[model samples]
Target: MKRAGQQGWSTTEYLAILTGLVVLWRSSQLVLEHLAEHHDEFSWALMIPF
Candidate 1:
């Protein structure tokens, strides 16, 4: 079996990615809540994927 560091992601790298994801999730939730509070003034457009 390959060690974590040897396989490319060390423990620190995993922790960093996890932390970043958590931050992003929290920020997105805040933004959505703000938009919901001011739905009349804020609108979100969905982008269509080709």
Candidate 2:
């Protein structure tokens, strides 16, 4: 019984980690798309000589 409970807890932890990773991945993609769409403005910022 104790082993089964531990297994359930482990599964839940893994699922949570996987869900977090998926959310991060999707958000990163959205950010990239936005950057691409606004590349002209972004490029101008990059051109500023340090």
Candidate 1 residue runs with Cα over 4 Å from true position: 1-9, 43-50
Q: TM-scores of the models, in the given order?
A: 0.64, 0.87
Compared with the true structure, what per-residue lDDT tens digits does model 1 show for residues 5-45?
66576767888999999999999999999988988664444
- lDDT tens digits, residues 1-50, model 2? 47988999999999999999999999999999999999988898888999
Off by over 4 Å in 2: none
Clashes of 1: 0
The top-ranked prediction according to lDDT is: 2
Whole-model lDDT values for every prediction:
0.81, 0.95
Top TM-score prediction, candidate number: 2
